[model samples]
Target chain A: MFYDRDPWKEQSMKSRTSLKDVAREAGVSTATISRHLNGSLDLPEPTRMRIEAAVSKLRYHPNPHARRLSLGKSDTIALILPDIANPFFAKLAAAIEKAAERHSSMVLLHATFNKSDREMAALERAAQNQVDGVIFITNRAPEAKVARALNDFARAVILDEDVPGGKVPRVLCDNGLGGVLAGQHLRAAGHRHVAYFGGGADLHSTQTRLEGLRSGLAQNGEPAYEPTLFVGDHSPTSGRILAEEFLRNADQETAIFSGSDELTVGILEVFHERKIKVPDDFSLISFDDARSLHLFAPAITSVRQPVDQLGERAVEILFSDAWDQPDFKALTERMPVELVERSSVAMPANKKKRPEKQL
Target chain B: MFYDRDPWKEQSMKSRTSLKDVAREAGVSTATISRHLNGSLDLPEPTRMRIEAAVSKLRYHPNPHARRLSLGKSDTIALILPDIANPFFAKLAAAIEKAAERHSSMVLLHATFNKSDREMAALERAAQNQVDGVIFITNRAPEAKVARALNDFARAVILDEDVPGGKVPRVLCDNGLGGVLAGQHLRAAGHRHVAYFGGGADLHSTQTRLEGLRSGLAQNGEPAYEPTLFVGDHSPTSGRILAEEFLRNADQETAIFSGSDELTVGILEVFHERKIKVPDDFSLISFDDARSLHLFAPAITSVRQPVDQLGERAVEILFSDAWDQPDFKALTERMPVELVERSSVAMPANKKKRPEKQL
Candidate 1:
C-alpha cells in the first residue's frame, strides 16, 4: 500500500483536470460556471446542461481542504469512538450527531475499536483537516502518546471511559455510584459473598466503581469475605472466559456484580451451558445498562449509566467556552448513575435466614 | 444562524473583500497581490508575510470553485447509514472506510436515523459536495424521492436494508434463507405453532423471510400452518409491546422467531418479568445475532445473519463490476444466513404431538 510514492502531493497538486475544463465545456466564463454551480445564480437550461455535462465527464469534485480554506470554518466534526458496534458507543454517537444537527455540523465518524493506534490516527486526521470539534470515546486508559496527540486539538472531549493523561475535559457517568448501586442491590437481596467483573483493575472508572461497590455491600454491616475480582477486557469473550474461571473455582460467591453489559453477556452464556440459573443458583447485577438486559431470560438487574446524558454533556463540553480556561482541560466531571432493578438478583438460599436489607 | 450573509456575495460577485486592503497591507502592486493570492505566482519573503497577515486578518478563505479551478478530484465518498449508532451500521461503516482507505479515499459519514428528512438532507449534501460515490443504508423502505436522490449520484450502493424504488445496486443478507432456517429449526424442535416477530410488514426483508419460513417449514411435507405475524417497529420498546401482545393472545404458539436482536431483547424482558422460562415455556430464535445472544440466560438459539459479511459485501458491491450492469439497480441478491443452535429451543412438553410426516 505504501508503494504509492505520491511525492507529487506537495508540488503538482493542481495537475488533474481544472475547472477551466468545465467552464470551457459549459460555454461560460469560469465565474459564471462557479457562481451558477454554487447556487449564487440561476442559469437557463442549455448552459446548466453544459456545465453539468462537463462536470460529470470530468468527475470534478472540489477538495474539502480548499473548500474549508475558502469557508474559514469547517463544516464537519470528527467523532472518535472506542467501538461503533458496542451499543453504548453507538447510542452515544447517535445522540451527539442529533445534537450536532442543531448546529448544522456534519459528523465524520471513526471507530477506534479501543485501539491506541486508531485513536491517534483519528485525532491526527481531525487535526490535519481542522474539524470544528472532536468527541473522543475510549474504553481503556490511553498511553501518554495518545494523550499528547489529543492535546494538539483545540477542541476535544473525552467521553465514556478514560484517557488518564488527556488535557481535555471529560464526560463520564459516576462509575463509583453505579458500583454502589449494584453492590447495595445485591447486599439488600441478602447476598454477603459477591464477586465483581470489571474491564481493568487499574482503570479509573473500574477502581471508582469498585470502591462504591464495597461501600454498598458494607452498608449491610456484615463482615463478608472480600469480593473476588475478575479483571479483563470489557468484551463478551472476556466475560465468558472470566465466568468460566469463576465457575471452575466455584466458591461461596452468591451474587455477582458484572461491570458492563458486554461482560454480562459472556458470563450468562457460560452459566447457561453449565446449567446455572440466575437468582436461583446465583444472582447477577450488571452495569452500563446499554444492552437489552431486561430482555434477557432473567431480566438482569443493572446500574443505568445515563448514557444519553453523558453523550449530550460531552458535546456541550466540547463546544463550551472553557477551552480558554487555565483549568478547563484538567477538569473531570462525573454525572450520576441510577440502578434499574430487575429480577436478576435474589437472596441466596443459605442467606435467607438473614434479614433482607430494604432499598 | 443565517445572519452572516456575505453582503459582498451580491456585489460584483468577484471580490469578497476589496483588493485595496491586500495591496495596502502587502505594500505591493495590486497586480502582484492578486497574482500571489490567486496562485498566479510566488512572491518575495517580506511581501509574502504582509500578504499572509492581510489574508489572515480578514479571514480570507478562497471560494471552493476558485480552488476547484486550480485542483481536481476531492477523492471522497459519502456514506449514508440509517443509524450510525447502530452496531451493525457502525461495523459496516468501519469496513467500508477500511476498504476506502486502501483506495486513498476519505468518507463523509451521515446517520439518517431512518428519518426521511435526514435521508433527504444527507443525500442533498452528498450531491452538493459532489461526492465520488455513496453507500446508502436504511431500515424502513424508502420512498420514490429517496430513489431519485440516490439515482442522481453517479455511484451509490444500497446496503443492508432495502429502498424499494432506489435505482442503485444493493448487497443484502438472504432473509429468505434466514427465515427458512428458523422455520426448520422450530419444526425440528417439535413446534408446529410459531410466531414471526417482524420489524415491519411492508419491508422487503420481512416478506422474503416470511416466504423462506414457509418453504423451510414445508420441507417436512407437513404443510405446516402459516406462521403468525406480530408486526412492530424494530426498537426494543416495540419489541416489549409486541411481546405483551403475544402473551395476551398466545394459546397454541410454542416458539417465536424474532426479527432482530433488538426486538428479541424486548421479548426477553417481558418473558423474564413474567417468569416465563425460555425453551421450556416457549422456544425463541433471533435474527442479526449482532449482540452476544449466546450470553443470554438460556443462550438463545438464533438464525445468525452474517453482519460482518453484509457490511464488507455492501462496500464491495459499491465498488464492484456489478454496478456497471445497466440493470444493476433492479438486482436483488440475498446473502445466506446460518442457524446457531443453542438452549433457546427445546422439545415441547405435554404437547399434542403433530403427526409425523415424511419429507
Candidate 2:
C-alpha cells in the first residue's frame, strides 16, 4: 500500500515480467523457474532451454528482493565482528561463510573495530535491513544499551564473547577450559609466578578465564602467588603496550599466559626487538591458535579455539526451528578448546638448575 | 502491481504505520525523522524525544529494504573476494569496509574460494539484491563467462588480479614493479640463477611480474639462463607442493621470487622442515606483504602490495560519478608497490667464497 505511489515500482512493473509469467510461458511450475534462475536446480537440456527462451521472451528479471519481501525473510545474516584484520576473526569469518552457505544464506559483514558507537550503528543497520538473523561478536565490555538492542532481534546469537544483559543463544569457545589448560601446563613446567595478558578486566571472558586459571593453579597445591593481571583490549597495539608494562614492572614472574594470539604477536615483536627469548626469559602460552603459530620462531604453545566448530554451531543455532522453545533463547553452548604444545612452554629458567625447595 | 494481492504486504501494512504518519504525528519533516532514525542526524533533545515518542506510539518500523526497493538502489555494495581466510584478502575487506562507511554503504561479503560457480552465484545475487555497486576481486584468471556476467552490472569495479574479458575499470597493484624490485634486489645480491613461484601462468599479474623479474634480472647482462617458472594456485598448499617440486628437480637456481605471502608461508614451512636455511642455502623474496612477514622466523623480505590504497581506490572508483563517461569503463589504475628488504637475500653459496671472474 505504501508503494502504491512509488515511481520506481511503476517503472519496473511496466518494463519487467514476473516469475509467474515466465513459468506460465514455459508451461512449468513457478518453483522450477525460480530454482533454475537461482542456479539451484538441475533441469534437462530441453527444459532448461525452454525456461531460458521464456525468460528471454518475457524479459523476466529475477528479483529476489520482491520474493524475499513477500516471504518476510531476506535469507541473509548480519555478521557484526570486532576486527577483520585480526587473523582470528578473519579465520572465524571464513568458517562462518562456509557454514552459512549450507543454509543458503548470505552474510553481510559489519566491522565494529571494538568501538561502541560502531557496534550500535551496525545493529541499527541490521535491523533496518531486515536481516533474518544476526551474529554479534565483541571484544570488550559492551554497554547495556547494546544488549537491549540485541534483545530486540527475533533471532540473534551472541558469539565468541559475552554481552552481559542480552537474552540470546550463545556459541563461544570454552574460555575456562582454555585457561585451565594453560595454567596446568605452566604449573607442570615449575612456573610459580605468572602474568596474564588479556582484554578488559570487566569482560565476561576475561573474568571467567581468570577464575579458571586460579582453580587450575591451585590444583597441584597452594599456589606460590596469585597470577598478576595485565589488562588491555585484545589487539596488537594493546599487546605491545601490555608487554612493555609487563617487562618494566615484572620482578619475579617466570611465565606469561596471553589471552589471544593477537597479544602474543605484540609481545613477540617487543621480545624479538629486545632479544628476550621465549621459555628462556619467560615461558609463555597464548590463547587462540588461529594464526600460523607453528611457524613462529619459537613455535608457540597455545590454546586452540575450535574456530570452525564455533562458527558452524552459531549458524546452526541461529537457523534452528527450536528458537520458539522457551529455553532455546537462554541456551549458552561452550565448545571445547585444545592445548597445542610446542617449544614455548618449558621449565622455568630460574628453576631449571635448582632442586625443589623443602616445604 | 505484483504485490496487490501479496498477503504479507497486507499484514505488514495493517500493523505498521508509515513514515509519513510518524512524521505527521511528530510534526517534523519526514526527512528529519528518517535521518534521526538512521542515526545520521543530530537533533535537539525535545525534537529527538518527540520523534522517538511518535515512532513508539505508531509502532513504525524503519525498513531499509522497503525504502531501498522504492528508491531502486540498496545502500550496499557486494564484495566478491577470492578468500577471506588469507590475511591479504582479510585486510582488503577491512579497508573496503572502512571506505564504504564514508559512503554510508554496507558491504555484503561473498567468498568465492576461487570457484567459478560461486563467483557467478554471488554476482547473480548482487543483481537480485539491487546492490548499489559491486567490487569484484579474483586471484586467478577468470573465465569469459564471469566477465560477461560482470559486464551486466550497472556499476562494477574489478580489483586485484585481472579478469581477461572484463571491461570495467580496474584497480590493481603494480605487479610488474613488484617483480622488478624483487628481481633487482636478488641481482644486486649476486643471485643470477633464480626461480619464480607464481599462480597460474595465464594470470595477468603472474605474467607481468615474471616479465619484470626477467628484465630486472637481466639488467646487468643476459648471460644467466632464463628464470625457471613454477606455477600453481596462490595458496599455501600450492606453495608447498611447488616447493617440493622445485627441491626435487632444481639444479642451478639459488634464489626464489615468490608471488604472494601465502606462497612464502608454504615455502618456509617446507624449508623449515627440510632444514634448508634462507639466504644460506637459498635466497627468497615474496609479494603481498599483507601477512606478518616482519615477525616471521627470518623476517622475510617482500614486495608490499599497497593493500589499503588498492581497496580504497576500488571503492572510490565504484562510487565515482564518472560512470556516464564513455572512457570511464576503460580506466585501469595501477597503484605503486614497494619493496621491504629484510634478511631473505644473500649472495649465491658458490659465489660467496670466490671473487667475480674478470671478463
Candidate 3:
C-alpha cells in the first residue's frame, strides 16, 4: 500500500461540494437532484425551484473532471471522416462543426483518408479520451475491425454509408432514391440500356443504389438485361480503370449512372482521351452533386445528396440525449436526395438510327 | 508557505542523482543536458550518445510537468483556416498534421469562416494554452486586430490567402505567376478583350494577379483597358453574383480569366443558363486547378498551383529550426505555379467578326 495513496482525494484540501449537499439542503434525495440537473426528470415546479435555489446558494459548479471520472465521458463529440481533401467530405465536416457548436459541445476532428490504420488510430484516440459520441464516415466499406472499434463506443453513429455489422445509430442520405433519380432522368432522355459504375460491389451503398437504379429503369423499357455492373472503389483512378474496361468490353449500354463524383471525373477523362463523347457516344449521370457539376463541359446531370444536411443531422443525432434509451443507439435516419438535371443526359443518339445497337 | 513554494529548484527527499549526475558521468555540463533534451542543442554524435546512455543507465526521466513549467510552451500547434470544408485547406491540414506528428506535436484546429471574432478567440486560446506555433489561413481580407493577434504568436506563418497583414512568415502559391500564365494562354489563343472575375479586390493575391495579368497581356499588344475587374470573396455565391454582373455589362470582352475554380463554377452556371456556349461564345482560362476541371464538358484550361507541394513546404517551414535566425519570422516563400492547358481557351469568336467592338 506504500505507493497506493490517492493523490487527488486528499482530505487536507477543500473539495468541491457534491449534488448530495444541494439535495440535503433542498430536502430532496440525490437522485432527484442529479436527474433534474441533467433535465432528465420532470420534477414539480416548487421542488424544482427549491433545488435550483439551493444549488445557486451552495455555489455548486459541478466539477467537470469529477463528472468525467465518474461517467468516463466528456461533453465533446468526434467526427471521423475519410479524405478531408475531397470537397464533399470537406463540406460535410463544416456542416457537422456548425451543428456541434449549436449543441454547446466541442468537436474532435480526425481525417481517416479511408485507411483502416488511420481509422483505427482515430477510434482508439476517441475511446481513450472517452468522447461522448462518435460520428464515423468512411468512403469505402470498412473491415470488421473498424466495426468492432466503432461498436465499442458508448454512443456511435454510422453516417452516409452503412456499416454492415454495427448496431449503432445511423444517419444517411437515400442512396436508393439517388439511384432512382439518376435512372429516371437518364431513361427519360431515351436511354434504355444503362451501366452502373460504383464503389465496392460489396458495399451497402453500392448494392442499394444498383438495386434502385434497376427498379427505376425497369419501368421505362422492355424486359431489360441487367445493367452492366462495374465494381471498383469510388475514386478517380478506379473510375478511369472501369471506363477503360467498359470501352474494351463492347458494351451495349448507351448511358452510365456513376456512384460518386470521383468516379465521374475518371470516366470523363478516359472518354475525353478516346474521343468518346458524353450524350453523343455515351450519356453520363453522376451521383453526389458535391462537386460543381454545372461547370463541367456538358453541365452534368446528377443525383444530389443533401451533403450539408446529412452532416448537420448526423451531429445532432450524435449529441442527442436519446442515447440512454435501449433503442435509441439502434435508430436510423435517412435524409432525402434530389435530381439535378443539367446537360449530361440527352435523347440517346442513334437509338432509332440503329435499333440493333440498343439491344 | 501555502503551497510547495516552487519546489522544482529544491532537492527534496529523493535520490540525490540529478541531471548534474548524468552530466558528470558523461563528462558534459548540466547546461548541455538541459539543452540536449529541449532539442535546442547540436552536440556531436558520440558525445550525444554517451550522454544518452548515461542518462538511461541512471534511470533518469525528466518530469514532463517540470519541463513544461520551465519551457513556457506546450507540445501543441494551432492551425486556423477560413473553411475546414475547402479541399485545399483540408489537404493543408492533413499535411500539417503529418508534419506535427513527426515532431511529436499535436495540432489544434479552428475554423474561422473568415471572421474576425473567431480569429481572435482562436488566437487567444492558442496563447493561453502556450502553443508552440500557429498557422493562419483566411479567405477574405482580415481586420488589423487579426494581424495583431497573429503577430503576437511566438512563431506564426500566414498560409494561403488568409492573412496578408501579419508580420510573420508566409507560405503561398505564386498567384502573380498563375495570373500571368492564364493571360499568356488566352493571348496566344487570340483573345484580347479579357475580363477578370475574382475574390476580394483588397486582397494582395487579387491585386498581384491583376498586375501580372496586365503584364502578361501587354507582351502581345499595347496595354489593354484595365482588365474589367469584378470582385467578390472567393465563394460560389460571390461567383454567381460576379457572373450576373459580367453578363449585364459584358461590353466587348471575348475571354474571361477567372481567379479561382470557385468563381468559375458560378460563371459557368450563368453561361449554361443563358445558353452561352464556351469557346463558341467566349474563351476562358481558370486559376487553381485543384478542382476536377479537366473532366468538364469543354475541358477547362487552368493554372495549377503546386497544391500538395505548397502544403508540404509550408509544414516544413512551420517546424523548421530557422525561427532563431535574424529576419527569420519575416520569411515569405512563393511556390511556383504551372499551367494546364485544355480546350476552354480558344480563338475569341466575336473578335474576327467585329474588330471595331474590341476598341
Scored by TM-score, the top model is: 2
The CA-based lDDT of model 3 is what? Answer: 0.76
How do the residues B92-181 of candidate 3 rate in per-residue lDDT, one tens digit apiece? 777777666666555667788878898888776565444567888888788988898877665778888847568888898888898788
Second chain TM-score for model 1: 0.77
lDDT string, candidate 1, A154-228, tens digits: 677888888878887888888888877887788878777788898888888888888888888886475545678
After superposing candidate 2 on the true structure, give the runs of residues whose Cα lies further than 4 Å from its correct spot.
A1-53, A56-59, A351-359, B1-17, B20-24, B27-59, B221-224, B351-359
Of 1 and 3, the candidate ahead on TM-score is 3
DockQ of each: 0.20, 0.42, 0.15
Q: List runs of model 1 lying over 4 Å from the truth.
A: A1-66, A189-194, A219-228, A247-254, A277-283, A348-359, B1-76, B90-108, B190-193, B219-224, B244-255, B272-283, B321-332, B346-359
**Model 1: pairs clashing at backbone N, Cα or C within 3 Å:** A70-B61, A70-B62, A295-B269, B174-B335
DockQ-based CAPRI category assigned to the predicted complex of candidate 2:
acceptable
- Taking the tens digit of each residue's C-alpha lDDT, what string does model 2 give over A1-359? 11112223423242367778888999999999887775558999999999999988875666666666555667788999998988899999998888888888889999999999999999988877778789999999999999988888878999999999999899988899988888888888878778999999998888888877877777646654678999999988899999999999987788999999999999999999999999788999999998888878788999999998999999988878687677998999999999999989888776445544433
lDDT of 2 by residue, B77-134 (tens): 9999998989999999999999988888889899999999999999888876767788
Q: Where is the poorest 10-residue window by lDDT in model 3 chain A?
A: A1-10
Cα deviation of A59 in candidate 3 (Å)? 24
Indicate which candidate wins on lDDT.
Answer: 2
Residue pairs whose backbone atoms clash in candidate 3: A90-B85, A296-B297, A297-B296, A297-B297, A297-B298, A298-B297, B138-B162
- In order of TM-score, best first, we have 2, 3, 1
Write candidate 3's Cα lDDT for A197-237 as tens digits. Answer: 98888888988898888777867355555778998887889
Report the error of model 2 at residue B239, Å. Answer: 1.0
Instruction: Give all candidates' CA lDDT scores.
Output: 0.76, 0.85, 0.76
